[model samples]
Structure formats: structure tokens, C-alpha cells
Target: MSPLNALNWRYAVKQFANTTLHPQQLEPLLEAIRLSPGAFGLQPYRLLLISNPELRSNLLLHSMGQNKVTKASHLLVFAAVQQIDEAFVADHIECMTQQRGGTAEEYQGLEAHLNGYFRNMSDQEKVRWADQQVFLALGNCLTSAALLGIDSCPMTGFNPEGYDQVLGLAEQGLRSVATCALGERHAEDAAADLPKVRLPAQVLTRVLV
Candidate 1:
């Protein structure tokens, strides 16, 4: 199906089927996030894959009893780095350089430039920067799932402090920015039959020419 058609078919899945997604179906979703576009290619986010039943059940509490958290086959928590220091930027540059067949000196110089740029930003600015990266990843994941005919829900209705504590993310210097639940749609979900709701093109579009 075309991208437009895939998007039209997608919805914020409120219920999920009991069947788990196969590895073949799951890998592409992951790959989409791994290759997601980010500002300056910093990719400052981490995707946590939770498939354990007990853990998912525990997370339901932190997520304010969102049934999707426990019902979905996989819960993806998108997190951003709490801090970006010189070392982190340097390491990322080095990895990219190696992948692109660049020399050490070339990568080091690039890293230096990145470090200088990030160091000049305020703490709030850094947080905003990282948050934007997480959103990019989330968008990519959602689109990918839609194209694959998988049911998903993009969620931001969780307790961040409780989540961080339960996930032990502070120890890794990461904080939750958003989450998504992926699985098959429950057979009896009434929302599945609802028509798509959207604004008309005239209201949402603009012609500058």
C-alpha cells in the first residue's frame, strides 16, 4: 500500500490482540527507529523494549493503569539522554566516522566541533534538544508500524518520575520522553470500527505561492 493509504489505515490502537508479534515483524519497527533522523544526527534517544509480562504489569501502575501497557505484546519506551557531555559526543562521532570509512583525525575534529556547540547550550536547551530527537524516533516508529499493518498507540500519559525509578534509567543517565505500545488489534475492540476523523485539506493546508 502507498504511504498515504497506510497512514489512513492507522489509528491510536486502544486494545490489542493476545497474539505476539513475530521477530520478522518486530525487526523492521526497530530498524526504523535505529535509522530515524535526528538533529545533526546526534540520535540522543534510547528505545527500551519491554516484553516481560510481569514487568509490563508493573509498568501499568506507573502508566496510570493504561491497559495497553499490559495488553500489548511490546511496550517501547523512548528515552533521551539526561546529559550530553564531551565524551558522549566524541564517542558518537567516532562510531559514525568508522561506519563511513573516515579516519580518526577526521572524526576527532568533527567531535571537537560538536562538543563546542553543545557545551555552549544551557541545561534547558539541552533537554529540549534531546527531547526533539526522541520525538523524531517516535514518529518513525509509528509510521513504520503503520506500513507493516501493526496496531500501535503513541502514549505520553505516564508518570515520568515513577517510570524512571522503576526502569532504573537514572543510573544510565536517561529519562523517559515518550512511549508506544505495539501489538495486534483486539477482535472485540469497538474503536476499530470507527471512521477516521480528520480536518479537511483546506483547513490544514496552505499555499504560499
Candidate 2:
């Protein structure tokens, strides 16, 4: 099917099959997030791949007892760094410059540009910027899953503080921004049988001309 048709078939899956996604199927979905575009090409997010059953059960509690958290074969946690310090930004720019055969002088110039932009922002602004990068990865993962005929649900109902503690996110310098479950649709999931609901193009779109 074409991208548009695949999108039409996609839904926020409420129930997942018991089966896990094969490694072949799962790798592409992870790659999609890795290659996702982000602000200033500074990818500030991390994807936590959770497949342990016991951990999933604990996560369900933190996610307000959402069954999908446990039922889905894979739980992808999208996390962002709590702060974008100068050291972090400088490191990323230096790595990219080296990969492209650029000199220290060139990289320092780029790093200085990014440092100025981040330094001028307040703490809240910095957090928001980092969070936005996580969202971009989430969007790419969702779209890529849909295109691959994988069932998924984008979720944000979890207790952030509880999750951070359970996952030891503070040590990693990361905080949970969003989550998504990936698996096949359950055979008896009624929601999957229903037609997708969406606004008509005319209502959702506008033309300047």
C-alpha cells in the first residue's frame, strides 16, 4: 500500500497481540527514530527498549495500570536530557564535524553558535527544547510503525516521577518524555475492527488561493 493508504489503516491500537515483534521487524522501527530530524541536528533524545516482562509489569503500575504497557511486546520509552549543558552541545558538534572531516577550528565555530543559542535560554526553555526533540523522534517512530503494518499506541498518561525513579533516569541524565507500545493487534480487539475516525480533508485543510 501507498503511504497515504497505510496511514489510513493506522490507528491508536488499544489491544496488542501476545506475540512479540521479530528482530527483523523491530530493527527498522528503531532505526527510524535514530535517523529522525531534530532541532539544529542535535538529537537530544534516547530510546529505552523495554522487553522484560517483570519490568513491564512494574511500568504498568507507573502508567496508571494501562494494560497496553504489559500486553505489548515492546515498550519504547522516549526520553530527553533534563538539561542541554555546554559540554553536551559541544561534544555532539565536535563528533559531527570530525565525521565530516572538518577541523577543530570549524567545529569550535559551530559549537560557539550553538552554545550562544542554548546559553541565552532559561531553564524552562532548555527543557522545552529538549522535549521537542523527543517528540520529533516519537512522530517518526509512529509513522514508521504504521508504514510497516505494526500496531502501536502513543501514550503519555504515565507518572513521570515514578518512572524516573524506577528506571534510574537521573543517573542517565534523562527524563521520560513519552512512550509507545508496539505489537500486532489482538484478534478480539474491537477497536481494530472499527473504521478510523478523522476529519475530512476539506475541513482539516485550507488553501490560500
Candidate 3:
């Protein structure tokens, strides 16, 4: 299907069928997330793909028993770094060096700039900034999933604290910011048949002259 049509057809699937996505169908969704853009290219988040049934059941408790939490074939948790420091900057710089075949010396300017900017911010500020970036990645993931004909539901109703402990995120200095449950939609899902409601484009958008 065309991207526009695919988007129009997509919705937050409330009822998932008992089906697992093929690897071919799953690969693009993962790639879209891996390639998601972040502020300053820092990518200050980690994408945790959870397929373990036992873990999903536990997560459902933290998610207020949202059916999709356990019914969906795959769960994608977007985790933001709790803090940004020189160490974080250095890691990205090193990865860039290997990916682009440049010396670490070539990235010193960028590294210094990022390190200084992050260091000046308080922990609260860093977390807020990282959280914002995670949402951007969430948007990308949702749109890409739609284009791939996958059923997805974006969720932020869960308890991050519960998730961190259950998923053992504190050790990694990551915190869950959002989640996306993906699978095939149930045939009886009435939500899938409802017309999407949105304000008309003219009323919802404005172009400054």
C-alpha cells in the first residue's frame, strides 16, 4: 500500500490477534527506530525490544492491565538516558569515528561542544531533554510501523519506575519513556472500523506569511 493510504488505515489497535510478525515485516520497523533522529544526533535513548512472554505479563501490571501490553507480539520500550555527561559524548564520538572512518581528533570539536552543553544543565534538565528526544523517536516508530502495515499502539500510561525495576534499567542508567505494542489486529476490534476523527486541515494548520 502507498504510504498515505497506509497511514490513513492505521490506528492504535486495541485488540491484537494471535499472530507473530514475520522477520521480513519486523526488520523494517526495527530499522526505522534504529535510524530515528534525535536532538544533536546524540540519540540519548535506548530501544529495548521485548518478546519474552513472562516479562510482558509483568509489564502489564505496571501498564494498568492494558490488554495490548501482553497481547501484542512485540513490545518496544523507548528508554531515555537518566543523565548526559562527557562519557556519553565520548561514546558517540567513538562510534562516529568507526562508522565514518575518522580519527577521534576530528570529533574533538563536536565532543567538546556537546560535553559543555550537557554539563551546564541540571539532572532534571538533562532528563527532560532526553525525554523529548525519546518522543521524537516514538513518532518515527509509529509512522514507520503504519507504512509497514503493522498494527501498533503507542503507550505512555505505564509506570516508569515499575518498568525500570522490572526491566533492570537502573543498572544501565536508562528509564522508560514510552512504549509501542505491535501485532496483527483482531477481526472483532471495533476501533479498527471507526473513522479517524481530526480537525479539518485549514482550521488545524496555519502558515505565517
- Name the lDDT of candidate 2: 0.88
What does the lDDT come to for candidate 3? 0.91
**What lDDT score is found at residue 80 in candidate 3?**
89
Window of ten residues with lowest summed lDDT in model 1:
102-111
Per-prediction RMSD in angstroms?
1.2, 1.2, 1.0
Model 2, span 57-103: residue lDDT tens: 88888998889999998999988887698988877977787788867
- Tell me, by lDDT, which candidate is best: 3
RMSD of 2: 1.2
TM-score, every prediction: 0.95, 0.96, 0.96
Let me know the TM-score candidate 1 reaches against the reference structure: 0.95
Stretches of model 2 off by over 4 angstroms after superposition? none
lDDT of 3 by residue, 1-209 (tens): 78889889899999999999888998998899889888777799999988899999899889988979889989999998876888889999999998988899988999989988988999899989998999999999989998888999999999999999999999998999999999999999999999999999999999899
Candidates sorted by lDDT, best first:
3, 1, 2
Over 4 Å off in model 3, which ranges?
none
lDDT of 2 at 166: 80
